[model samples]
Target: MKPKVIRALGVVSALLFLGVLIAFAQPKGETVKVKGEVVDLWCFLEGGDRGADHKQCAISCAKAGNPIGLVTEKDEVYVMMGLKDHQPGKEVLLEKMAETVTVEGTLVKKGGVQVIYVSSVK
Candidate 1:
């Protein structure tokens, strides 16, 4: 093959490899439903804070723009995001803070952190 043709082929091969890597790196969102208690990240991580009794405080923190987290029955915790139009937006999580809830949304795990883009909470 001509040298120039070989170089072009190599470039194309490199681009294809990069595309594959990116696809694996960023996975598409998948619908998920989990039962857990939504908690204010601050108190939850610091003092083991939780329980329906702490509902008011958890809601307050969340309303104040604090990060919200969910603790599942298996003791797994995940960062929760209220997504609207593909961005962080409206939330049904704050009101359920510190209370057991069943939520449905897209679950994503990256960089060792679990995040759920919340859609509905009940």
Candidate 2:
């Protein structure tokens, strides 16, 4: 093959390899722990929401005559465990909002959203 063509092929191959590596390097499914204030919980049931935006769902629920059961924090590092099986309110077992506690569960991504399917809390 021509020298220029060979070099271009090599560059393309390298870029492709890099892309694959970056993709695989991301965490798939793992156990995680998170601590924060319970801000919203019910909207999570309808699906299509997760992460920082969870607070919005909480607020929305509160306005709509439903319990806004979501945990929110400014700097709390949520140890995200991949998705599992658990009810909305029963998943995270803290009684009040702003209560400091630890939650353990599988960090799962469903429909391009990351959430911890809580297993236990304290």
Candidate 3:
């Protein structure tokens, strides 16, 4: 084989390999499903009251008795309480964390944590 031809093939192969790696590295913004026992509910409301200040809401929700937080077998954590349109104490079939009974929504990184904005529960 000609040296130039061999060099071209090598470059092509390298480009192809890089493309594949980039494709896999990108996060697919698809909803996934996950399932686990109801852990702790991290409610955004305070003292079971919906009309609380932001800081108060956080503290109150933590005190309220509900499973707003979810944990998977892999120790992935999610906060479900006080999100828009989501109800507390309701069983869910999450999507993004599909390794278990969880269902999907966009998994976002907030404050150095991975959380899914749950779209539905089955």
Model 3 backbone overlap count: 27
Better of 1 and 2 by TM-score: 1
Top candidate, metric lDDT: 1
TM-score to true structure, per model: 0.70, 0.40, 0.39
Better of 1 and 3 by lDDT: 1
lDDT of each: 0.79, 0.52, 0.49
Candidate 3 lDDT at 83 equals 29
> What lDDT score goes with residue 98 in model 1?
72
Give per-residue CA lDDT, model 1, range 14-35, as digits (tens).
9999988877654358889989
lDDT of 3 at 77: 62
Worst-scoring 10-residue span by lDDT in model 2: 77-86
Per-residue CA lDDT of model 3 for 11-108, tens digit only, reads 99999999998776544444566665334344322232222133344334444644455566665666653224444333342221212345455565
Off by over 4 Å in 2: 1-28, 41-86
